[model samples]
Target chain A: MAAIAKSSFRKTKTKNAVLPYLYLLPAFLIMGVITFYPLIYQVIISFTNFETTHLLLGLKSPDLRFIGLQNYIDIFTAALPVENFNFFRVLEFNFWWALSNVILHVPAGVLIATLLNAEGLWFKRIYRAVYILPVVVPPLVVATVWTNIFDERYGAMNQLLTNISAAFLGNADPIYIRWFEDVKPPIPGFLPGAPLTLAYYAMMVANFWLGWPFMSVVATGALQSIPKDLYEAASIDGATPVQQFWGITVPLLRPAMIPAAVYGFTLSFNLFNFVFFMSGGGPARSTELLVTFAYNLVRNLRWYGVAAAFAVIIFGVALIVFLITNRITRATQNYMEA
Target chain B: MAVNPQSTKNMFVRIMNINTSGQTAGRSLPLWKQLVFQLIALIILASVMFPIMYIVTLSFSSITTRPSKLELFPKEISFVAYRQVLDRPTGNPVTFIELLRNSFMLSMGVGAAALVIAVTAAYAFSRFKFKMREVLMILVFIPLLMPAVGLSTPLYLLLNQVQVKECKSGETAILPFTECSDGGKGKLQFNLRDSLLGVGIAMTASALPFAVWNLKGYLDTIPRELEEAAAIDGADANQTFWQIVIPLAVPQLAVTFFLGFIGHWQEFVLTWLFLSQPKDYTLAMTLYNMTGQYANSIPWNRFAAMAVIVALPVAIVYIGLQKQIVGGLTTGGVKG
Candidate 1:
């Protein structure tokens, strides 16, 4: 009986030890092959002068030589002979794009959410559902639609502008604003590569349309969590609506909003689909972001080594950004904080 | 338990006061202020809907001439562009139906794989305490944080090198191959590039992280009591999990799957990178290919129709799953 009990206990212990690992196996295996392997592979490839010639042979090829940090140096120093390939410019534009998007989106989102959160607001649900159109429509479609809307002769945007100019300026020759093709920066010397151009504004308009609804949805959720009694109490105390809004609502919404803002910033930072499909990082690549430029290096230029190195840099930048934001917002600090 | 008429009356009066207070506050806002707010909202809505409206109108119009002016309301509607989209008699060999089929297959395969992989992993994270769990959880989420395109280079290369072993029988190669063709024996290697299966696998990598994160948060909320009860009833852990937790997790799993499906349906960048064959062209890739270096190569009307076609499934899925999506997004933030 003692031996039997001991054997059963040992069996259960072994099972217990193995159960979680069993559950985790499938996911870890898939992620290992696809995610982890590629990341490690990218790091290795980044260190080598891997190109199209080494494509067929892969790593086992004798001609595939390891060149340390040269790819990174070429990218940063603008030594690559690709057209308008400057790293700092792309980096600067990426930062500016994300920052400006957040700046525009957060306030608009809050205001809209607050309005929609009104006590007697009619069709609020309808408004929210309609606004969610942008969120549902993929970036590729959104970019394509917006691109056509901004077309020089055939676009509605220029037509709208033309009508406005006709109404106001009495000039009806059609104000054909070259939205995507204009290389000249609307604001010179603002970004490192003088990155803020008319195309940037066009993107701002298009992305603002795409971005704000998400923020509003997030803000709306946060707003709903705020107790109704807080407003009633403030009102009972003879506080103005503005006062109550600023004092009660703003402070209450911060914890949620800060993390959301960080998320929004991160998303826009690496918004490859929109920037790629919409602008193609054109107008002399002034609007090219780090990710898009890296993609272009592969797709158009086929500079595999440099592109891999660029990807590594992007990964590093993403990690740093995530860490900084996480530190600031404590977004991932649940365990530590607790 | 004492019935107090006085207390009840006081509560009634307080409720009345609250209602009146709300009413008065609503009335106190100047008429112009409300009007201005509504006006701004309408204008914003108009602007938001402008591109959509343009696309819709353009899709309805004839392709004889591109409209010179803004035509929000179509004067004469035609289905010519839709016909063109449906029957591609021109540049690409792949038809619209084929594109739809490819997109559907790739996205569905990706969605199912992501769901299956994420569900088990999420269950483990939510239910168990183990070594390296936190580290592994962080590892799972790390991919979500980085731009997916950043890793596309290595995947592009890796997928390019994947070779399925083909066995040689007689003079012909028998393709139910069991071994690696790397040894230069009586075997041939078939590279998996430009294949739907390869693209689907690549897409699953991008979709898995969020699926795991969202599902884990949801599973965390499901009470452990049921599983515990099942354990008490002599059911093993696996039995308890399969019977109780999976059924409970179905709704969330559906939500995750739909979200992924909608995303993968419209994914083009990876498809563009991995696939060179026209047969594997997704609807998104096909739509993207409509535009050329010069703007007028593809007619505007046909492009609009194609955009509509590409966006339709996504729109339907989103509208159908709006509540779940909104719920998921809001909750997903703090936890994710």
Candidate 2:
């Protein structure tokens, strides 16, 4: 069949303008009601003393006080009735938590992916399959399971420790490691006010189990994207495997892993479930994440206004995070611009 | 690791086909290094499998009490735990079937709702050159940056306001329930935020940004020339979009839907926060309820079985669609 003549069958610009909005109308409706409207409402409630009593009529409740940023002021100055809670300490701990997760997960991911990426590795398929299992399990399950695993008595961690001692040091008694209940920081003064307790270490172990496979999966995808001929060329150029890794593999993996690390950082920073479910922000609220703390304000204390204020503060921090990470990883950059 | 797990890979390179290499030193590790890698892999595998094996083992055990002994494997194969878990997951009146149904409905509902709205928005962003396009895109995605739990307070309050009052008006809808906001008084009927529907709405709100972004990326990759060709054949914009573009986007639509499905299925925070009724309980919530009890009161085997029930569907779905999900996942990170 002969090619048809090219024609301007598309709608006029003025008419077409409405078309895009029409496409977006439903999205905006849902998002507006659920996201933006609530966001604005959250901002509004942050200024008032909204609590459980206000749940019925919201700000319209006659008893609700318009506190005029008193909640924010109270939070910043630690004037809230909540115990052992410091705003800046949670912020500092949040950053440290995210940074530490990235510090551990990224390198370990790269290394594991590199090892698994090696040609002719036996049972590599099985290994990859096994490692990916953790990724599939829900975080709720992971958190609950890990909490039990770190249980002082029936926990597998203490049991494993007990077994190790029995084999090497002739002590058959069960070891009790109060991973969640321990209050004292293992390394005191390391993070200043935000003490990193034994629970933090246990959390790191659980999250490590939770976090690495994803990075490894990301790294593996990046590894395959790397030109095999680059490795072949490096081999011919007398570059050792170590040198090849440092030179070709690491640099190429950067584009992929950098974005992933930033994503991981943000995720770990906001990780509410693991922190909340594992320790309940406990052992004197040492391992609390910002989100978890904000949640606790509403859940346990019924301090809705303070929780709103805390949430707004979190939004600001998240904005800063988005900006910094946008600069570093360009994760949200549009397709054309990138 | 409370992650949605949208990032594991096997798209272009099948796991079985990972080592398609000639016997050359350039690719393969040395004999000793291979052994070392295997050893390390085994250690990691064992550590990773420890919790999973423990859960599976305990689920199959007849004992209901928490095992103090270091038992990693199933000594006896029994379905008592499963039977108990299925019969009654918690002390709450909810049955396992209701839990599963709630989980299925919330996840599938949010997944479908998000997909329908997201695909259109993604298409507009992909194909149109309009003012505030970038602004609107950023506006929609701003929520994605904020921790979802942070937004829960407002959502809870907002949706909570939309309640049904059991008034003389025969179950009237009320915002802020002002006793019908008239002279007559009405009892508070249904709090929207305190039900599965309200939680579903919230999840959809949270689920939208990611779905829109992911689908938009896919839509952008689809060429305009196909639509142009259809246009030359006398097709209008909607016709072309429906006939040409949507069919093309089917695979990606599935990808976005399943990705969100996995997360929503496992979601406990919103449902746990919003719903108080035992009948509205999801599998995740029931499982959570079982764990918060004292160790002595807790039935360990039943808890393990509940966990398996909650985890199995998601695990199966992830493994089945690992390649497509991870591929869609990597394209975003790598491209960005």
Candidate 3:
């Protein structure tokens, strides 16, 4: 019996050693084709001055000479010609937009989830589903819907705003705000300050509407997973509802919060559909994101090498953000678990 | 530890009396408060559905009326805009039949392919404990983070090279050959740009990450004991997976499949990016085209009509599959 058991154990060990690799074969192959190959190919193309004309003429030969780091240098410091649009300006907007997305997404999600999780909240599922409706809707459809809503003349939003102003301020002279128009107007109630362009702000509103639901859903899930006993104990110890939330809920929910926050930030950085469909990086390129800017360079303007450099920059930023957040969260996890 | 019977009866009566009085006091709260909450909820719901309602109403309204005046209900009903969008002439005049065929075929192909690849990959990730397993798991998310813009140039170049080869051999090129085949005329002989296959592949690549991640989460929740029990009963690993695991995961499989289908059905970026020719546009792309440049050239009524037609099928599918979607989310949420 002992001899037979030993033989079975040896057989199992051998099977286990081979099984993992065998199972991983298909995943690795798919990843290689879909992800790694394109990645390597993109890095290679960044070295060359490949463009639409070159591609069309079958000039993408291996014999093309490499220009070392010129593309990267040009991307950072290169100024646009008088006839051409500035590329760095687009990158700057993308950075600000992504930062703002994190600011809005995380808190909005937390607040909504907390409200829903409160005791005596009725019709929870209905509200949750209603909130998440935008997420299920296709990005194109969302963009199309908002385009009409923000229309200068026929838009529902403008009409509603006009009505409200008329009722409250008695000024109803068919007020129409071109949400995406780049023209600046004087600030109301701010000491006659210079007017600011709202093109980027309008796009951000549409994006915020599209993105907030995802954060809320994630936060709600995280909130539900917390143990009820902890809240009960807090209540017994004479903790106020607000105090319990800050002390127990926030700290306990961090594990889920960190990941959701990182996702929101990364998603904002790579946001393409919202900017593309709503603003089209229009009104003097005020709303162009890094991704959209890169796309315009390659697909529209035929500047392949420059676009590749921009892509590399975007990737680098994303990786740095991801790593820093990952390290912080992992450390927090260790602390909590310990 | 034994209690006195008389004391127990008295305690129960006291509890009942307290509960009845508390219920009465709760009932004394103003009915207006409940009405106020309901009113607030209704307003929120309306806000959520307002855009869709606007599109629906405008779709049925007359073109003579300005779009700004369009309300929740059409003043007069007409299908003129729908007819126009359906019969609108392209340079090459693509028919409604062709558009539907392209969109349906792309969605189905991509959905099917994604299901197969994601299921296998997810199963492997969930069941196996291997070296670099965690690293491989993270690798699955790379495509999600890597925006499509970054991949477009290389893909275009690669496809262009392949097209050149086909043109040189005097065979019908499989891709949109921008230069070699058309003698630099910028016209493709056999444009893969508008082909269902190309669109499907791009959609599949984009949707794979989410599908894999979701499926892996589902597979993890299933107990290992079931598989071990099957093995004890002389079942092979494959048999166990097919008979036991797959059967139990049917609901999840359905949800994933529907999500992939809907996602591909409404996909615009990839379809627009790959298929540049007007003749090869999908339904979403077609709807976008109806709005025209500067977004005002096309009459608002006609644009709304086109949007309605485009969104109707998706809305129906969403409502039909609403239960599955909600169930999947709730289950996945709690489990994760």
Give the interface RMSD values of the models in order: 5.7, 3.5, 7.4
**Could you give candidate 1's per-residue lDDT for residues B62-92 as a string of tens digits?**
8646668988877768999899889992368
How well does candidate 3 match the true structure in TM-score terms? 0.80
The predictions' CA RMSDs to the true structure, in order, are 6.0, 4.4, 8.0
Error of 3 at A186 (Å): 6.8
Supply every candidate's count of residue pairs whose N, Cα or C atoms clash at under 3 angstroms.
0, 0, 1
Please write out the lDDT profile of model 3 over residues A1-338, one tens digit for every residue: 99999999899778877776775676567667756666677787788776665665334455465777877777766552323245566666666788788888788778766765554445655666677666666667777777777777888778777877888999967778888774553344321222224766776677777777667766766676777778888978999879998998898777666666666666677777677777777766656677777777766777776677777777776667667766766776687798
TM-score of each: 0.90, 0.93, 0.80
With a 3 Å backbone cut-off (N, CA, C), the pairs that clash in candidate 1 are: none
Tell me how each candidate scores on DockQ against the true complex. Answer: 0.36, 0.52, 0.24
For candidate 2, give the lDDT.
0.83
A9-57, model 1: which lDDT tens digit per residue? 8998789788998999999999999988988898898988888888856
Q: Supply candidate 3's per-residue lDDT for B18.
A: 16
Fnat for model 2? Answer: 0.65
Q: How is the predicted docking of candidate 3 categorized under the CAPRI scheme?
A: acceptable
Worst 10 residues of 2 chain A by lDDT: A1-10
Q: Chain A only: list TM-scores of all candidates.
A: 0.93, 0.92, 0.82
